[model samples]
Every structure is written in structure tokens, then in C-alpha cells.
Target chain A: MSELFDPLLAPYDERRRAELVAAYMAVEHAAAPVPEVRFPALREPALRRTVAAMLALSGRTLVRGADRDWTSGYHDDVAAALAADPACVLPVEDRAVLTLVLVHSVAIPRATGTLGEDTWLSPYPAAADELRRRSQLPVGELEAALRRLRTAGLVTQVKAGGDEAGGYVPGPQFHRLTPGARRRLQEELILAAGPDSPLAAAIRARRRSNEEAS
Target chain B: MSDEWAPGILARARARVTGAVSVPAAEPVPPGLAAVPDGPRTWLLPSWPDGATPAVLEQYELAPMPLDRSGQARRVLAAALRCCWANLDDAPWPGVPAPVPAVLDVYAGMTRGDAALAGRWATGELRRLADTGWLVLDEARGVVRTGPRTALWPHEALGPLRDLLRRMPGPSREALGDE
Candidate 1:
């Protein structure tokens, strides 16, 4: 049984172990990124590594947010591996709806130079009316898919307020994505939304070079 | 537990986050999940560390995943629990399956018999609960059972839920067609 113990976590007492586990749970379960200050256990390098190891035992990665917070999410490679099984992926309709929202909320604004952030979250929500107009799916199917997406935390509905008509924005789940996953999503969006752009060409070139190097 | 098992474990873990993953009952359970064995197949339900639940998001004024008509859905779930969870000593999952009408009857009892509109709403909520894995609705048999998620409810949290369930009135006799 002693041999089963992880050396990193073995240094901590039972109470301290519980605290670290609690911190991991807090980050893993929370809908949004948890502030680092809220859990002092996470600040210790050893405890942080232990938590990362624990997360890895189940195929998760601890995501360090730009805002000095923490969350847990799947690594891009693991997700890609899982994508080989069709049952593991989002349904095509759901994927289509999500792509449209991303294009409208993130890609379009970035292309027009109105959004400056490198992250997926955007203040500019994609309106339902516009999505309906743009989608090839029937209005009923689109509406149903949007409902499912909202419930799953992939897209959130914004109430109509002050100068802004209510619409949908990428939800808190985006915050759970690791940096690599976020960067890959950005590249995919660029490729899909502006395939003719020089940035897309550069992305294709980089992918080719990386493949050759590997 | 060699390094070779890592990819398969990771894929199952990722798949489980959004939906239930069924594995062979004879297989060893994955790291973060609790197995609910059902004959030859086992459903993997993700387990969280003690004292931490998704409700923690509310403490920071952050919304958890959105639920459509959450109140109605929860009430319907409660009704199902009241009907299926006959033995208070046992955990909620793998509870006795109850007929849909029986669950609906209990739901109606909870709401003081606003039967027509309430019945429709309850039916819709039941379907939604089934979709989200809160309840398993066997449409062909018209039976409902608690889903694996209920088993994840912390033991301490069950006390209050048990009390609330105890105080809840059972299915109305007239609603059950007994003169």
C-alpha cells in the first residue's frame, strides 16, 4: 500500500491532503475559473504538481487562466484522440451551431478589428435572428440546437439590455480550455472563417512544417 | 496500471464529462468515476472530491450550466425520487423503478393537484430530466428510475433531501383512481 502512494502527495499530512483534494475539486467542478487566492493550497508548487498529477490520472489538465485563476479541462491531444470515436464528439448540428456563434461573435469581430482579446469570450453576442438567417438548418432545428448548446454551457443567452439586443455568446466552458486548446480553436476559426486570408495561409504553412519536423 | 492504458482511460474520462460512457462490467473502473453495474454493462458516473460541488459556482455569483425550466424539472425529479426511492437506508440510484403515472401522481400531490397544465409541464420536465441523466425514462415500459447522477449526491446533502421527501405527501388516492 505504501508503494501505491504518490511521492509528491506523500509529503502532505492527511488534513493537507484533503485541502489539496478540495482545491482540485473546486477547480474541476466550478463553472467558471476559480480565483487562485481562494485556495492557498494551489499556490504551493508541490501541491499544484500533486493536483496536476491527480488530474492527469483521469486525463484532465489544470488550466491556468490569464486572470490568475485555475480550472480543469481536457488536453487537445486527448480530445483529438477521443474524436476518433464518433460517439465521443458533439453532434454535427450542435457543432454547426457552435461554429456559427464563434464566427459571428469572435472571428467576425477580430477580422473587423473591433475585438482585441485573443480569448474566445466576446462582448459582442451573435444574435439569434442573424444566426437564423445565416444557418442552412431549419429555424426549428437551429432553435433546438441553440437550446441544447445553452444548457450544455457551450453558448449563453444574453438578456436584452441597454443599447445591446440580447444574443448568444460563448459560455463559461470556454474558460476551462487549456491554452493549447484555445490556440488551436483560434487557428481552426481562422481557417474556417477566412480561408483566403494570409493568416490562414501562414497557419497551414506552420502545420505543414510541424508535421515535417515530427 | 501500465502507461499503455493511459489513452483509453483519458478518452473515457473526456467522454464522461458530457455524457455517460458504458463499459464492460468486468473492467476495472476508471480513476474519476464510480461504476453503476447493470448486468453486463456498467455506467461510469464522474465523482467529485468531498465538500465540493458545482453549487460552489453560486458562491461566487457565477451561473452553473443553464437548465431549461429548472424548477419544474427539479420538482419532477423529486417526485420520481419520492416514488422510486422506497428504502431510505439505501443510496438513490438502482432504486425500484416506478410507473410514469405514479411519479406524475406524486408530482401532482406536491403541487396541490393543478393537474391539466401541471401534468403537461411535468411530462416535459420528466423528458428533460431523462435527457440530462437525472432520471431514466423507459418509454416502452412507462417506468422511471433514478439515473446514476443521483448516486453522486453527497451523503451529508441527503439528510435534508430525505427530510423534504418524508414530508412530501404520497400519490393521491383519487388520482390513482381509487374511489
Candidate 2:
């Protein structure tokens, strides 16, 4: 179904929906090391609209952070629509597992020098193990969430492991993110992870090398 | 307006654009030989030039829409509509009914602060796009879907966009698995 139609969230009462939207936004705009929401703000129409727009455009949501007390990360669609349209919004729930997935999809590529031309993909069990390390959610719950992300088109299964097991790569939506949105995300990473961070350096060196190669 | 009524209101507005004519699916192409060669001689068919397909041409025609008041509003609506279309899995494909409230959420999100005003803008834009026959709105069902025009968005037309997106850097680089 369209990301527009979220059955999991459709049945909630209006107030609860409002609260979830509010909570999602708090972490989305939070500037702390880890973003969290204390009281869901009921008065921010712009924030609400932003979330709706992001969800509408991308079918992804912001969830509470797991690695940190309160943090935010793009769950599905890998920030494609939000990156394209900076005016977008996001979701909250299954915070840690989803964050781990997002980090795995978005971050780890450069860290491992596996980005560009050939994307480094991971098997489901490997992702599950990493997610288990970061969050308190059980294996089943993490798998369920991963399934949900796949259903949402945020991540796609790839043919790997020679039929023994399949791996995953970023979904089609990941490639749809706008350059501006991608740049903004990179800036955020540079600030949080620092310009001298190994991943950042890898990314820079990759770009420099690619430019020189071309 | 209270948050309670926002969704309902958006749905009702979308219902206003309901009803559209569906076009027939495109025709299939005939199969042909890849290439042929005989005794150091070769015969080759000229390659079809890029942008020669109907879809590409149609997309090119629709590409330069000005992003003014209604223009910008219409684009936002289009994005939401695309999502509505994208989410149609197991619902008999692209003709799935879309919730107006969901489509409006996209516009409302972008406009922020004044959802009422944004709703008005969206309603007006929807009507306009509907009038152009590019979008079909089912007001009674409170859903919307792409009109016949969108069928023209050929795979080739999106090539450049896909390339650009592929080249863009991701947000982070934290390793998650041993692989």
C-alpha cells in the first residue's frame, strides 16, 4: 500500500496520533547529542505538517533513538524525500532497531570503504545481531520491525550469499533523495561525528579519488 | 481548526476531485534480432534515439511547469499522490484509492502554520489538475490516483534523476555487521 496508508497507525485515536506526531518531531528537531521528547508539543502546526509531509512523501518515520537516550534517524526510504525536500517530517517507535537499520544503511558503507560502484550489503542475521547489541528489543521484535521496513520499501532484499541466505541493499527510495537533502545530512554527520572522523575522511577521500580517477 | 478535524477535513477536500477517465494500456513492441553477421559482412539496425519514446516525450513536455503559488502547491500535491500510488501493494496495482487526508497531509506539512489556507490552495490545485485531465480524483471514496498522463512517465525519463540520486552521499557510515 502507499506509504500514505499506514494501517498500524490508522486505528489510533486522534489525540494519540497527535501525540505520536509530536513525539516524532521533538526528536526530529532536537539538537542534543541524542534527541528525546519530554512532553509532546500540541501547538506546533508546522512541525505536524512537516511530519505529515515527510511521511506522505517518503513513507518513513522518525523513531526514538536507541544508542543514545533520545535521538532521531530516518527509518525507511533512507531520508530520500526528506533530503530532496528539506521541508519534510518523520516517525517514532522501535527506536533502537530502526536506528541501527538506518545507521547500517546510511553510515556503515563509508566506514567500511564499501560505497560507490559497489554497495556493501549485509545479511538479515548479521543485521539482527547488530540490532540486538544496541537495543533491548528481542530478536523476534527486531525481525518484525525489519520486515515492516521492507514492506514500506525503505530497504530491499538482494540476491547474495549464493542462495544460502539473502542480503539487503538500500531500497529504490534511497536513490531518490535530493542532493540538497543529502548534503544537509552529510553536514549533520560531520558535526556529530566530526570532520576528522574516519568515516568522514573515507567519504572525502573516496570523492577526491573518484574525481581524480575521472 | 482543532487537530481532531484536520484529517477528516483533508479527506473531504480530496473527495472533491474524484472521477476521471482511464486510458487504455500501451501497446507492446515486436521482437527483433539483436544483430546478424555473415562472412566478414554485417547488417545492423540503427539504435532508437533516446527520448524517442512516447513516455519520454510526454515527460519532457510536462517538465517545465512553473513553480509559482498554484504551481508549487500542485507539485506538493503530485508528490503526495505519487506516494498514494506507491503504497498500492495487493490493492490491484496503481488504480488503488488514495485517502485525500493523506494526500493533503503532504501539502499541509509544507505550508505548515495555516492548514486551512493550505487546504484551500490544495483544493484549488487539485481541481485545476483534474481539469487538465492529468489526475483522477474519487471524491466519494475520499481517494485519488494518477490520471492517464502519469502512465507516460517512462523509465528512460527518470534515468538522469536516478543517476543523480545514486551519486549522492548517504548520511552516515557506522558499521553494523561483520560483512
Candidate 3:
């Protein structure tokens, strides 16, 4: 919101460019049950392991793959990283934010594959929330952010559990996250799992345990 | 431009109405681009060529765009432009032969679709073509302009676009049905 913050972001913005940075992060990274991934369970190391296992598999794809599937790679990368609780501790860095936006936000890649244009997913509420939290900023501007993402086909009003019946999940509406939206989600994941990433080795160990158990 | 979804999204909507005319011999778009029954009639599509500037995508009724980062915006705009051009151009003109400027301008006003972020810079580069002519728009029929142009067609140019849909990339190319 403040012009001051905009200039400060320049350096961070420059560093986090490209759609397929974490090329190794893949959707098949964690073979654990998708439905089993719950927020409260995220606190448990065992469950976190399951998530981490999945995350490690994904990290490879993000860091290694030449061509990435926006839907599969993005969802896998973000889901695994979020489960590791990147937001809870380090709170998702700007680099990770860019990763999330790159893969998850179709608006950006959709722009790239066609027009040599790429509109990142920084405007996303989840993305913005994560950014504001890391920057230690407040969440005063809701209407403006929501309006832009919605129009850009990035963000949507997420109706959680109580908002629906027993069949519904307690998360944002699927919102038809496109290939472009994947870019946004991926950027966030990358930031959450940087070079000194705590989630990396942690996820590997979890996977090792799961493999041994199985 | 308005942020409300534009008309002519489907075959019927794009048909010959009292005022607007549809291209003749146009085929029904495959399900991926024109699954009329499944997808919403309204969509916030990104305008092409010039990137999806808030102003451009807004023109076609898409709104609530995130406002940050020129780099990201430019990339997304490029992708959206490709999607639109790929589908709308029934002929699929690839890389227009004329100079980038005049071709882009005519493409913009003609396609009535503005994803041409490149047009802002390349407008002056296009040369007037021998057969291409610019038709002034009256109230009913939007004007038609021909001659040297900018922008890529993805396919061969069928001369000056005879109809609104004619000037556009085929609907199947938009990847709408893929959704």
C-alpha cells in the first residue's frame, strides 16, 4: 500500500524471476493420501513427514524439470510446502512467493506462452497475506487486492467448511486455479523452501521413514 | 474498457444478429474452447498483442486483476495473447508478414481484441499492403482496415477480415474447452 514498500521490493523482485526455478518439485512427490492432509495434522512430525516426503519429491521437479505441468506441479509443490508449515515459521519468503505465483497463477504464464508477457500472482490474497506477514505489514487493503486477482482470474472468495455442508473441504474454493495461478503458488513454495531450507532434509527423512514402514 | 463479459462468446451469440454479423462457413468450436454448456457464458478473458493491461483485459469484461510487477504481467499477457490468437483466428495466421506496426493497429481495431502490448511500440513499423484497405466504421458495422500489418496470425491471412469472427483466431485455439 505504501509507495515506500514498493521500492524496497525491487531487489527481491529482481532475484526471483523465471517460471520453473524449482523444476524438480513435482505432484507425485508425496504419494500419501490427498484427503489425509489436514491443517491440524500438519503440526505432527509424522504427518509433517508425509507432507515432507511429498515435498522432497516435488522439490526435485521444481529444481530439475525442463517443462512443468502448471496444474499438477503447482498443486503438488504448494500443497507439500504449505504442509511443512513454511508460513507458520519463516512465513514464506518473497522468492517462494514468486515461485507460487509463477506456477499457480495462470495469468502470468498464460501471458508468457502466448504474448511474451507474464503477469505474476503477487496480488493473490494468500500470497499477499504471506508477503505482508513476512514484511511484518498489516492487512488493511482487502477490497483492492481481491478485486484485481478476481479479474485477473487469480483469486476467488474461498468458502470454507462451515460455509458448506459435510461434503465440503475447509479451504478456499477450488477456484479453478489455472496454469498461470500455478506460477503464484509455486513462487510461494520456493520461498518457503529456500537454500537454507529446513523443509528439504526434513521431508526426505519423512519419506525415508514412510518407505521403510511400507 | 468495461469489465463486464462481452457478447459473442458462443456460436449462437456470435451468429448474425440484428446489428453484428458472424463469419460465414464458420465451424462450431471444439468442446475445449466452446463447451457452452459447461463453462460460464461470462469470462474475464485477457486481451491480446499488448499484454493484459488492466485497461485491455477490462475492455473485454475481465476484471479484478492483480496489480503488481511489470515482468509478470508482460509474460501472462503474452500467454493470454497466444491463447486468444490460437483459437480466434479460424485461419490461424502466424507471424504477420507486414511491418509490425500497421498490421498490429489493424489487428487491434479489427480483432476488437487488444492483447497487443507489442503494438504500442511496433505500430509505426507496418507498411500499407497492396490489397489491404481501411474501411471507416459506421454506427452498425465496425470499420474494416486492410494493408501492411503487425502481429503474428498463427495461420495464413484470409485477406482483410470479412467478419468479426473471421478476424479472430478459432475458438478451439483458446483452450476454453480444456477447462
| DockQ by candidate, in order | 0.40, 0.01, 0.02
Q: Which stretches of candidate 1 lie over 4 Å from their true place?
A: A1-8, B1-5, B49-63, B109-117, B174-179
lDDT of 3: 0.29
lDDT of 1 by residue, B127-167 (tens): 87887678888989988988877877779889988988889
lDDT at residue A97 of model 3 (Cα atoms): 35
Worst 10 residues of 2 chain B by lDDT: B27-36
Chain B alone, TM-score, model 2: 0.47
Give per-residue CA lDDT, model 3, range B1-179, as digits (tens): 12221222222211201111112233343211212111222111111111212232232233222333434333322322333333444433222222222234334433333445545422311211211111111213221122111232222333443244343442232223233
Fnat for every candidate = 0.32, 0.00, 0.02
User: lDDT score, residue A93, model 1?
Assistant: 93
Better of 1 and 2 by TM-score: 1
Decreasing lDDT order of the candidates: 1, 2, 3
Tens digits of lDDT, candidate 2, A1-214 = 1123234346556675655444443333333212223334323554444444433322323333223233234433343323344223223344345455656655666656655422223333225445567757777876666554553445665544565544444443333233344564555455445677786777787778988998
* Each model's lDDT: 0.78, 0.43, 0.29
Candidate whose lDDT is highest: 1
Q: Could you give the DockQ of candidate 2?
A: 0.01
Error of 1 at B108 (Å): 3.7
- Among the numbered candidates, top DockQ falls to 1
Kindly list the per-residue Cα lDDT of model 2 for residues B51-109, writing each as its tens digit.
Answer: 12323223223221122354565555454454445532222124445566666665565
